[model samples]
Target: MATSGLLNTDILSDEIFDESQARAPAKRCDRHSHKPIDMYCQTHDKVGCSTCMADDHRSCQNTFYIPEFIRNNIYQSVSRKIQTELNKITKTLAEQASKFKQDKQRLLERKAELLADIRRFRQEINDQLDKLEKNSVNEIEDKVKCLESKIDDGLKQIEALEARVTTASNKIAFPNPYQPDVFVNMKMADDAANVANKYMKDTKIKSTVEELDFKHDRTILTQLEQIIALGSLTEDPTKMASSLFRIRGDKSYCVKVKSDTEDCYISSACCLEDGPIILADHNNKKLKQIRGYNYTVTDYYDLPERPWQVCSISKTDVALTLPLQNEVHFISGEEKMKRTNKIKTDFECYGLAYTNNNLYISDASTSVYVYTLSGTKLQHFSETQSGQKLFSNIHSIAVSKDGTRIYVADFYNGLIVLDNNGQVITTSNGKQFCGAKCCYITKAGSVLVSTYGSSVLQFTPDGELIGEVIKADSEGRSESLSVCCNQQMSRMFVCSIDDNIGVYGI
Candidate 1:
C-alpha cells in the first residue's frame, strides 16, 4: 500500500507540472535582437531583456528584474484594476446618456409650449374677426330697420290722405247730401289733396329706393394674405455667468468703395459673422460687400433705389431699407450677393434692424414699425403710452441682443431707449448725442452712436456715455453715418458720407 501511494503522488506532481508548462509561454522582446524579456524599465514603462536595457535604458534610474518589479509593485490584481476602470467609464457613460435624455425632454417641452402659444394667438385673431363680423352684421341690420321705418311712416301718411279723399268722395256722392256736409267734405278733400301734393314733392326730394351694401376693408384682407405666421420662433437667450468687458476702438482702416460716376455716399453698413462687411452706397445705389482683412470689394449688387439703412439678419443674410421705394430688400450669400426677397412697407422705410426673427424699421418721420420676417406687421410705435411722441426724425434703430430693449437714434431727440413694447425707458439727450444719425449695439451690449458729423460716440448699455471712439480725420473728411460691429466685437465698420468706408478695430 505504501509503494502505490508514492507512485500516485509522483503521477500527480508530473500532471501539475505539465499543466503549468501548457498554460504559460516564454516571452521574448520583439526588437531586432529578439531576446528573452526579463527586465522592467520603470522610466519608459517598458519590458526588455538585459541587452535591451543596456542599449536603450542605460540612463533609466528605475530598472529591475521583471520578477522583482512585479513582486514589489503589483499589490493588486491587474484584472481587478481593469475591471475598476471599466466600471468607472460605464458609470460616466450612463450619466452622459441621462443628461442627453433631459435635454431632449426640455426641447420637447419647449416645442409644445410654442405650439400652444401659436394656437392661442390664432384663436385670439379668430375671436376678433368674429366680433368684427357681428358688428358689421348689426350695422347692416340697423340701417335696414331704419330705412323700413321711414318707408312705413310715409306709407301711413299716404294711407291717411287716401282715406280722407275717399271719405269726402263718398259724402259728396250721397243721394240726400246736405249743403253744409257737402261743403265740409269739399274742404276736407281740398286739404287732403294739398297734403298729398306736398307729400309727393317731399318724396321727390327723398330717396325712394335704398340699397344696402357691405364694403369690406381691403386692408384687412391684404394684411391677412401677407401674414406668413402668427409669430416668430427663436431660441431663448442663454445667461452667461461671466461679465462682459468694455471694448475700445484701437485702429481705423479707410477703404474706398466707390466704383461709379458719383462719389459713394455710404449711408449704412453691416458686419457679418466672420464674413465680408456690406456697405449701402446711397449715391451709387448699390450694396457693396468688402473684405475686412484686405479691404477689397468682393461683390456688389445694384439696387433700384438708394438703400438708407442695412442690418445683418444672419451669417449670410442681410436686409436693407430703400426709403424711396418704401421697401425692405433682403439679400443673401456667402461669397456673392443676390436679392432674395423684399417687404413693402406702408411708410417709407429708413432705419432698419433685425432681432429675434423680427424686423424693426423707422420711417424717418415719427413712427417705428415692427414686422415679422415675412412682412406681417406686428406692431407700430409712433407715440408713447402717455401720448408723447417717441421720436423726432428717427433715423437708425437697433434692438438688444436678448430682444428686450430697442434703441433709436433720433436726429433731434438724441438716443432714445425703449422696452420691446415701445414704452420709453430712458432718453439721453446729452451734448455728445447731437445729431444722432445711426446707432449700433455691440455683442457686449454697448451702444455706439454716429452723430451727423465725423464723431462716433460709444455709450454703455444703460445709455451712459463711454467716450468718443472715432473722430474727424486731419482733413475733416470723415463724416460717419452708419456704424456696426462684428459678432465678436473685435472690429467695427463705419459708413461715411464720403466715398470710403472706415474699418476700426475694437
Candidate 2:
C-alpha cells in the first residue's frame, strides 16, 4: 500500500495530466522498509535490506549490492537518457502553446468576417428603403407640379379675357359714336367672355392636394431595432461596467439614519428616481421616508398592523403588506395621507413590489402572487414548485425594467431569477450566497442586494457576481438588513435592522 501527501499528489496529478512530464530517477527505496537500498534482491524482484532476506526471501538467489552492480559505467547513460526526455518535453510544451495562440487568432479573424457581413447586409437593406422613400416623395412633388400648372393656365386665360372686356367697355362709355368698330369690338368681347366661361367650367375641379398626403406606421421604427446583437468581442470585460456604479475596497457611509435615537428595525426599503426612500418598519408599525440628500425623517405614516414590506405605487402613493392580517394596503396622498383600499389574499403576503400598475407579491405557499390594482389575481409563479434546496425561503422580489425578468433573493438559496410569466430563468442552489435579504434591480440591469450579517453586493442581471457594493464598517457595528437603489441608479439606500440607514452613490 502507498500513502501520498498533498504536495506528492499534486505532482503526481500534474505528471498524469501532461504525459510528457519527466521526473528525476528515484535515489532511495519507495517503501523505506530499510534505511537505504543497499542490496538488490533478484529473486524477490525488489531492493531490500538484511531483515527482508532473513524473514521472507532468505532462500532467494542472485542478489548483489547496489554500488557493485552500478560500478560498470551506468550513471552517465542514465543522465543522458533523462536529459533527452527533458528536451522532448520542453519542445512539446512550446509547440502546444503556439498552437493554442494560432487557434485563438483564427477564431478572431472569423469573428471579424462575421461582423463585416452584418454591416454589409444592413447597408443593403438601408439602401433599398432609401430608394423607396425617395420615389414616394418624388411622386408627391410631381403631382403638386401638375396641379399648379393647370391652375396657372386658368389664371392667365381669365386675365386676358378681363383685359379685352375692359377695352370694349371703355369704347362704349367714352362715346366713340363716329367709330363703327365699337359694336364689332363689343361683339368680340362678348364672344371672348363666353369662351372664358367654358374654360372656367373645365378647370373648376377641386385643387385640394390633401389627398396626396399619406399616413405612416410608427411601429416600423420599433421593428427596425437590432434583429440580433453581436456576441463576439475582443474588448476587455472590465469595459462592460457601468459609469454610475462601482465596487471599491474601501467602504464608508454617507449618512447614518436614526443613529442617535432608538434602533429602528427596517424590514423593507424602496425609492424613486433620486427621491426619498420609503421604509417599512415592522417593529414600529409604520412606513417611514428618509431624505436622500440629507438623511433625515421626511415623512411617515402609522399602519394598521405590522407592515412586512412597502413599495411605491406612484409619486405620492405606496402599497404596504400586512402578513399578520393576510392582506395588503394601498395608501395615496402627498401632504395628507389616507388608506384608500385593502387587498385580502388567500395566504400571508410577505413582500410586495409594483411594476406598470401590476403588483408582484410573495407569500407562504411557495409561489408569488400577481395582482392588478383592482385586486384581481392574474397569475402565480413557476411550474416547478418551491422545495427544499433551491427555491426555499424567498425573502424579497423585484421585476426587470422591461418587465421581462424577475429577481427573488432567497434566504438560503442565493438569488433565483425568473421570467415575467413565472418561469425559472436561473437558480443559485450551489453558489456562494450569504443570508440574502432585500433585493433590487437597477435600470442599467445591475442587481444590488444586502445579506444578513454581511455586506451589500452587486451582481450582473444574469447572476454573475460583480463585487461587494458596500462593506460593514470598521467599528463592527451592525449588519445590512435592507437595500434599495433608485430607478436612475444615481443614489442608493441601505438599511440595517439595528436602527441605522445609510445612503450611497451609484
Best by lDDT: 1
- Residue-wise C-alpha lDDT for candidate 2, range 112-181, written one tens digit per residue: 9987987997788899889989988898789889988977876787788788777766766665576677
Query: What's the lDDT for all of these models?
Result: 0.76, 0.67
- Which digits, one per residue and each the tens of the lDDT, describe model 1 over residues 1-506? 12222112122221112222222125877783567788867666666788999998899887888665444443234445556779999999999999999999999998899899889988999999999999999998888899889889888988888887787677667733567867877787788778888888978747745555678898676435433356544332222112232345444444454557687788888877645678888888898877635567768998999889999999888999999899999998665789999999988899899998999998977988889989999999999777988888988999987788889999888899888888888888966677998998876677888898777777777666767777644254466788887644356777776766665655
> In candidate 1, which residue pairs clash?
none
Instruction: Give the poorly placed runs of model 2, Cα more than 4 Å off.
Output: 1-244, 247-262, 382-390, 471-477, 487-489
The estimated TM-scores of all candidates read: 0.50, 0.49
Candidate 1 lDDT for residue 189: 71
Q: Give me the displacement of residue 488 in model 2, in angstroms.
A: 5.0
Give the Å shift of residue 65 in candidate 2.
34
Write down the RMSD of candidate 2 (Cα, Å).
14.3
Q: What TM-score quantifies how close candidate 2 is to the native fold?
A: 0.49
